[model samples]
Target chain A: MAPKYVLHYWPSIPGRGEYIRLAFEATGTAYTESNEPKTLLKHVMSCSKVGHPPHFAPPVLEIQLEAARSTKSRKTETSEDVKSSSPFFLSQTPAILAYLAPHLGLDGVKKGKNEEDPEVDQIRRAQVNQITLTILDLNSEVHDSHHPVASSAYYEEQVPEAKKRAEDLRKVRLPKFLKLFEETIASNEDEDHLYGSSLTTADLALFQLIDGIQFAFPKRAAALEKSGKYAKVFALKQAVAKLPKIKAYLESERRLPYSDGIFRHYPELDGED
Target chain B: MAPKYVLHYWPSIPGRGEYIRLAFEATGTAYTESNEPKTLLKHVMSCSKVGHPPHFAPPVLEIQLEAARSTKSRKTETSEDVKSSSPFFLSQTPAILAYLAPHLGLDGVKKGKNEEDPEVDQIRRAQVNQITLTILDLNSEVHDSHHPVASSAYYEEQVPEAKKRAEDLRKVRLPKFLKLFEETIASNEDEDHLYGSSLTTADLALFQLIDGIQFAFPKRAAALEKSGKYAKVFALKQAVAKLPKIKAYLESERRLPYSDGIFRHYPELDGED
Candidate 1:
């Protein structure tokens, strides 16, 4: 049996976790989410030094495979402050994705066709990398929609700036992103996925991106999705949704609806076409 | 001799290519740079359809090892038009770092003493990811220094707003980032590297990041660097610089300096204490 995968994400908002969820769905993988109510409400004492960052942000897909007790612990766990020592238990989103991609077959896309086809993998990997970066850029845009100035500042404080950012996102960023995805799909005519015909992490990401955008900007997304250019993306999303295990999971309580996730809808941060 | 690698980068900038060059130097990899001005300029068109977009601007790394030619003959290439249909390429700076870290023996820090410990990899990988994301945030700040409004806008046009953004970046973002690196180093008390006391991609990135920051924000960086908190980061930069191959490479013309790269110097954007 494969390892029992555990996803650590803030319970309320989908934010980055949706990508992981969609990826698992696309692969028909069974995993549990560790999104307890206290996870968010409780204070997170960030790592001071010794260990890795304690669960670097949410949406971390923690691999539950037991190590062989792991190297006998060079860094001693005994310290007056846990913060001072005990080595970080875990953190870093890309590292998690890199570790999981190979296990989940999404990484195989990076490899070339033959046993020696590591070259082939580069194209796929690059595609995934590019999309992921784009996703982050989109994320920044999305973030600016609510917090146009300081991210740490409240929406109420920056509501006016947020309105401008939101308007810009709706008018410029959203369409630009959708068009880029549409172009990517159109460019990859024969291949069923972003890099190649078979599905990969890039596709899962695209699905999540579209889903998030649609949720956050329903009016704008409706207009963009109606343009008929997103048929392939729509098809990809439908395919992921229709996956037997994924569909079952979505239907079940496991699949949370979009609310406070990365792509949150403040309504006013959104507008109609 | 292993295959001579082909490095495809925009010849104009040292952005992402600098990281790759640092890795290659560390590994003693002999590779030819395909910094053809025409090729770099031409590839920009096809870059749009290449699937992913960086959250903003960037330098992408292309793996130059030869693969099967005639990617153009294949319909897959047709989906995404290319000025030159290269068989395989990798993009997004962090992903490229992840790919190269293993090949360059930078993974030794993560691989652990036994060489079989996966947790070591996970822990180190996590740190590298954490540092990379922080670097991206830092770069975004650097970009905002020049164009606070949007990337689509001209830099000169946004100089007034850029000054305010740069002020915020210098006072808040720069100190915060420097402090983070400083704290990580001070807390670890380990020699050199951020993860497990051995050189890794994190170290290379830290070196470049500090170098870029110092070059771009001379006044602020001078203050931050003089504040004495980033001692380890400074030490890491020196350690990496001392590596024979790296030193030779940096001295040689192959290592380009920053001008129009992702990290730029616009003295007007900054503020005095």
Candidate 2:
């Protein structure tokens, strides 16, 4: 039986949760991709769920584990008996991705189950973790382009600062990240994926990372594309887009574009050199 | 034989690597503690060691592994025998701890070699990762204490914006983090440790987190500590201070206090109210 994955993300834009969605899609996994913002809001507002909640934000993955509840245990029950019928819900996209990847057979590790080889799994997961960490860093960098002056303050208030920072960010950090990816691809003996020569979730993740960067910094990215070092990365990204599952999802109303999400484009924040 | 730990750190302060150091001390593990900062710099700087061709900051843990060394039969003498030797360095503190915990018997399920228990490890690790993430966020908040207005600008350049952001930060986020920790301890069944009962690295980490917060925001912490909900947490901090290895190390010339590291104090940033 194919495992069903219900990925709950914000309806508006493809933010952090898109990585998980992409991985599930790439592997041809059966999953419910729901972007019901109302559903997400309800979960976030709930007391049991929002324990030590975020300072501000949404896009939580609500996971439902449906197994045959033991009818034998239900006959006589104490307060702690019967066992939780309602499934587990976790926030934090990185944590959720780390949790889910192995279950989907996309991660190739013992992962959460501990059934497979851990030594190998540890290395694999570490590689995955490294990729995600880089993605998170990239996301933060994109956010910084608009709110470079103050994360708490309005972007309008810091437009001057943003103008200054965006110049160096585009020229310095953008190329650095690209060249890093280029070198990573160049280092790979295999033509296909990032780690152990398999199409792990990391590549799917890097696609989102680069895609988001390109969306936000088109003027800068265009200059970069002309430089021609990241052809393999760009090719992999195009190939990922061409996947039938991904193509269908993109065509569907569910797939979101970059606007008011983690990757926001501000033409004023753009600087060309 | 007792597991040997080759901790790669700055040789200056117990920043992120302190968590591992604390674990080693608590267990009384017999191992070589090489405090070679220059050696660390050299190893991390070497492109041949890491796959991506540069350093990802300091403090990489080196583990020795022997692989089958997959090489074709003709091999052509392997083009100068390009292969890594006995030691393998793992970056990121969380990655290193995950590698060492099982070996040190700090892990719960000791099913011996090849034991694949991911849940027992994952729950604890996820919790640990959450705290580490929180601490990093908190440290960034600490950075805001000095340069709240911008990352690109130096401390002196953004003093005005820093002051206002720091004031708002002290009044709001500082208390929020402390209260969360207080609540975590008060609500936990195992009050001593933040994660599931007993002295896992998470408890020591929380102590470090709190200690850093206290050091960085003395006045705000004083106000927060008045709640008295973190009695066990405070006790754990005290207990860690008294640990023979930690105590000796602390008394030795080795342990250094906060400066420009992750946790820093800006007199203007903190407030009593």
Candidate 3:
């Protein structure tokens, strides 16, 4: 049976697709990931559906409304309903996450009297997105540490520059970003989440970011973890890992390993504290 | 009287904040930008308000609800209303833009009977955000062309790596992104906008992205423009610039010049196509 949600990305490494995957896995939602290169290429290279524009890159989400399945028996369905029920494609990791977060119940809900207020909902959504964007920004910087010259070029080709970039990332950037997350987590009343008193897409994104950093920069990540300053952040990572569904997914075959993806384990790039 | 929107960013140079400024200018909205370094630093460096978290970087938007002004006369106002009317600080350029776009009427409106459908609204918002994010991704790459190793380091410190990065950007990445935008614009029924049949924050974002690219890489930008391949994109840029308020703002003192910001013009970095 075709799932309601389909994810099209590179077949091999997790890359940015993992952020989307984590959201689904955490929520125990059923989603289909296109692991076949040919099928994936066709969907990503062009507009697979009418009314959808071409995607610039991978990690695209195609959402088919459930009502479309029952449309065969319903004679009252209008053209507008048919168009609305058609498969909708969206790209950009953050954009996909934001769209899915609310549906997945990861975009924290407002409490009490403000529950019905759109302004409160908007503020909550923006806060979650801002934190997710910051995590991704650091994730981009991590990728650059190894491929500083050009992402197209191999790390071996840019070793000298990579060394400089990785050194700065370890000595300056990583700590700065980690501290910001630490402060942010401390600010929230709930110690386990990045936003409100709940697990949000931002928390899932942060978990993946720290997991990638650990894979890419073990020595630096270890030192920072040992420092105890980012206790809240590490706690959140542990909390996310311990989620029943997320744990099952991580140990399952669906979770791809890090290789030549954005978060790469290059020994020379890792530095001691 | 204070404007409803307060923009906090660096005092000089048209950086990411310019994207937000263009949205306001194009809509003729009243906004105050904090030009003093100290005032701006205070808002960005710490949580200026009790409920807000510390911003990771600049381009933070402080939105004060209008109901707060009439609170003195409204004796029946509840505490929930007071809290909702408090100033909300949001960071992240795309987040700020997404939050402001709908209010500015740049998120695009549905013209048909499906207008009331929340799913339709969500899809439209995601499309606008996805395009805006893609443009910003290209913009980030342009910034990296000059400061390939580290954003904190001076461009002079990484000139060797900058050359290689800029070469890839000018010859490969820039053209690839431009082609995608061109295809997207052509895909739309309205040739002037990137998404629907109207001006959106995505269009405003694309205009600023191209404007900064032209300023930073004159040779490559001019070659691409003269190639006439991306006719729709350039036409869109021209359309955005010719907006009555945008034209006036561009000529006003409020619009800062490009300097040592994200899009820097190092003659050595700008290469021939």
Chain B TM-score by candidate, in order shown = 0.79, 0.75, 0.92
Rank by TM-score, descending? Answer: 3, 2, 1
Model 2 chain B poorest ten-residue lDDT run? B68-77
DockQ for each of the predicted structures, in order? Answer: 0.26, 0.22, 0.55
Which of the CAPRI classes, incorrect, acceptable, medium or high, describes model 3? medium
Choose the strongest candidate by DockQ.
3
lDDT (Cα, tens digit) per residue for candidate 2, span B1-273: 232457778766767777677667767765455568767776553544455323354556655333322232113324323243224456656555545665665443325421332333443444444544554556556665675444555788877766766776777666555555555555445566554455655566666777887888788777767767545657767776777766887687656787766677887777788
| Order of candidate numbers by lDDT, starting with the best | 3, 1, 2
Q: TM-score for candidate 3, please give it.
A: 0.94
Give candidate 1 misplaced runs (Cα > 4 Å): A25-30, A36-45, A48-50, A53-56, A67-90, A108-113, A116-127, A189-191, A266-273, B1-3, B45-60, B64-86, B109-130, B186-189
lDDT of 1 by residue, B66-174 (tens): 3333342344444243334343455566777766666667753534343454444554555566666666667666765675555566777656556656777887677
Task: Give residue B82's error in model 2 in angstroms.
Answer: 13
Q: Which scores better on TM-score, 1 or 3?
A: 3
lDDT-better candidate, 1 vs 2: 1
Candidate 1 matches the true fold with a TM-score of 0.80
lDDT of 1 by residue, A220-259 (tens): 7787768776677677777766767667877887667877
i-RMSD per candidate, Å: 4.9, 4.9, 2.6
Q: What is the lDDT for B246 in model 2?
A: 68
